[model samples]
Target chain A: MDAEKKNYGKLFFSTFKLSACTFGGGFVIIPLMRKKFVEELHWIEEQEMLDLTAIAQSSPGAIAVNASILVGYHVAGVPGALVTVAGTVLPPLIIISIISFFYTAFRDNAIVNMAMTGMLAGVAAVICDVVITMAGGVLRQKRVLPVLVMLLSFAAVRFFNVNIILIILICGAIGAADTYLRARKGAGAK
Target chain B: MIYLELLWSFIQIGLFSIGGGYAAMPLIQRQVVDLHPWLTMTQFADIMAIAEMTPGPIAINSATFVGIQVGGLPGALVATIGCVLPSCVIVMTLAYVYYRFRGLTMVQGVLAGLRPAVIAMIASAGISLIILSFFGQRELPADLSGVQPIPVLIFCAALVILRKWKVNPIYVMAGAGLISIVVYSAF
Candidate 1:
């Protein structure tokens, strides 16, 4: 029981540190998480970490939080999930709350405004890089279906302004139907 | 009443926003800017910038910021809880089932479809942000006359630096901030 408590503590602290230090959003957190959990701590295996990331991405909510919950649950259990969530969220809550108090002042400050203007440009560039890398990954796979789905999704969002939720549901249904048909075909062949 | 509203709004955001935090931006804009008048478009863009710079998920950071703007500390708590609740429940449930059926083709196919869609959503979000950065405060079909040249230069430079050098995004942002400060002071 003591060992288990210690394990949970370790899980909580690691998540806390990871969330606090990580910038550039969810994708940036994954590699750092692997280093801390898989390489340094040996708390989770490499393969498990990959699976957790995949599930985290596919599941709802923030990938960073989801990934943390999976890793925490794997290491401990429900308690681990709760602790890690707190750890993952607390940093931003505290930081943003402090910023909130100074929101008006920050808004009025000319220097700060200038800096923010510049940062917005930089952020746009970073996001563009993300777009290119993700699109390249899909293209490299050379699968017609995924490529089609990607382009369709892009057009739906960019041109039609389709609701994001509806798109996800439609894609999910398509995926399920495709999988069911393939499974049935396999069964027939056997 | 406001607390409950915040909770419901974010719960929807949390539940529907798949792929990652960036994918949550449009949902957030719809809820905060369109459905509710909690924040103006410019303020929403600012929140996006702040959320990106800060540590943690963009969705959580956004929730906290929007929650504080709409309510107070209590509101922040409520909104954040609402935002993360779906994640905890869904991830925990999926984790168990996924481990059990790790080899299932059905699961793989669902993920395969979801993955690219998520990427497209993220790319769409990036494009919107780019528009906001260049046009500044105006919506789509922005007036070219109002376009700021310095930000355009900064955007191109930052993109080149990031793509060629493989530098961390934080440094690029910091450098841009410094350059802007210097330029503004000089002018």
Candidate 2:
């Protein structure tokens, strides 16, 4: 039990440091996680890390937090997951607190305003890269439904002004049906 | 009451933001910019800048920032928890059944379906931002007169550098900020 507590401490601190130090979150942090948990701490295996990452990516919410939850759970069960959640979340809470405290000051400062305005362009570029890359993946799949779904969903949100959440639900349903059909066909072919 | 509202809103974000941090952008934009009067498009852009430059998840950073604006430090905590709570429950359940669920078709199918939609959602958000940056707002003017030259220059250059040279985005973002500082100071 005492050893479990010690391990939980290790889990907390490792995730805390990762949350605090890493930038460009999501995929950027995955490799570092692999290095730390798989190579350094030996808490997770190589393939397991890959699987965990896959699960994290496929699940909802922030990949970083999802990945941390999976890692923590694997390392120390539900309690460990709790510790890691706290660790993963606290750093941003602290850092953003400082920024929030300076919210108006930052908003009012001319240089800060200009800088943020400039950064907005950079952020747009990055977002463009993401959309292009991800859309390219869907296109590469060579499936008509996913592509149709992509375009229609785009039109729905951008033009029709449909709610984003409603779109997600409908698309998820379609995707599940597509997968299930494909799976059934594959089994019949055997 | 405000805390509860923050929590519920972020909880919706958490539940819906599949695919990753960028996927959360549209969700956050909708809540803060469109649904509520909590933030303007420019301020939303500012939060995105900070969230992008900061450590941890963009969703977490966004939740904390917006929560602080609405509530305070405790609001930050509340929003952060709401942001992460779905992930916690979902991931724990996944871990519990990881072995049995490997290559599960239903789960795979739902995510597969979400892919194109997620891409579209992200693209929609990106285009709005591009408009916002180039025009200094999310909506475009009837004529070309309102275009901001600096953001246009920065946007094109950043895109080219990012695509052609494949530079680290953190450096690109910093470079963009620095260029703005220099240009503003010069003018």
Candidate 3:
């Protein structure tokens, strides 16, 4: 029993450690998560990792936090979930607190500004990579219709600035209808 | 009263934003620009640029920046807490529910619909950022001299290689930061 408890604590520690230090947000965290939970610890599998990413994305929260909660709960119940959220949130909270305390000095510094510009460029690249990769995955379904929906959504928001939330709601409706229609067709075939 | 309003607004953001941080951008922009009018588009973009440079989630950084703008330090605290609280509460509750309904078909159907929509949100965010970077500008600069596209290129290259080669991104981020300092004249 003692050994089992120790195991949970260690797993708990590692979960937050990964969460706290994870830069570039959700997609980048995927590989690290798989490395720790699926490969090293065997806590979950690759497919489950992918599923969790979907769940985390669809849920209303920061991706890192949602992922941490899901993984924490998976590993050691509610306590683990609590610890993971704490772990993920602690670093940001501390860093932001420090920045808030000395914000004026930090904001006015030229060196910091320069560094920030470079960092923003880097962030854009990271976000770009995510979009391209996910787009590729979506395209692989070999269904042109969803591909068109995705492109039109991009065009609408990017060029027309038609409000993304509305696009998402529209696409979601289409997806639901697609699923229902397919299910009905399958039932008819049976 | 203002602080309470700030807190509630962010909590609404946290609870309803279905596609994580990136997806929250448009809604957040609406709040910052249309409803709250705390920051202009330019300032919001600048703050977003700053958040990208720092560690942690962009949404939290956004909350901190906007909060500070609205009510100084106290506003930042309220906004940050508000941004996180709903998700934290919801996730905890969901953890319990997830265990019980791990095998239900309705749950499965909902997830299937949710997944692609999430991806769509991320794509939309990327587009939003791109628009924010270069939208409705009157004059193109005579030269690309003020902006060093090289650093951005190198950073992107490093990220692609890191993702492709399975390298540690922390080392990559640290290395990029150091390289940026030495390679450029601190702008």
lDDT scores of the candidates, listed in order: 0.87, 0.89, 0.66
Name the regions of candidate 2 deviating beyond 4 angstroms.
Answer: none
Where does candidate 2 chain B have its weakest 10-residue lDDT segment? B99-108
Where does candidate 1 stray beyond 4 Å? A181-190
Q: What is the TM-score of chain B alone in each candidate?
A: 0.90, 0.96, 0.65
Give a tens-digit lDDT track for model 3, residues A52-134. Answer: 76667666778877888888888777777777776776566656656656766765887765554455445555556666667
lDDT of 1 by residue, A24-82 (tens): 67877899999999999898888888888888887889989999999888888888999
Per-residue lDDT of B155-177 in model 3, one digit per residue for the tens?
56766866697554445545555
Q: Would you list the clashing residue pairs of candidate 3?
A: none
lDDT of 2 by residue, A70-178 (tens): 9999888899999998998889888988988888987898988888878999999988887877888998989899999999999999999999999999999998888
- Number of clashes found in candidate 3: 0
Ranking by TM-score: 2, 1, 3
List native contact recovery per candidate, as a fraction of 1. 0.85, 0.91, 0.33
DockQ of each two-chain model:
0.75, 0.87, 0.36
Q: What are the per-residue Cα lDDT tens digits for candidate 2 across B45-103?
A: 88888988888799999998998889888888888899988999988998888956565
Candidate 1 chain A weakest lDDT stretch, 10 residues = A126-135
Model 3 lDDT vs. the true structure? 0.66
Rank order by DockQ, top first?
2, 1, 3
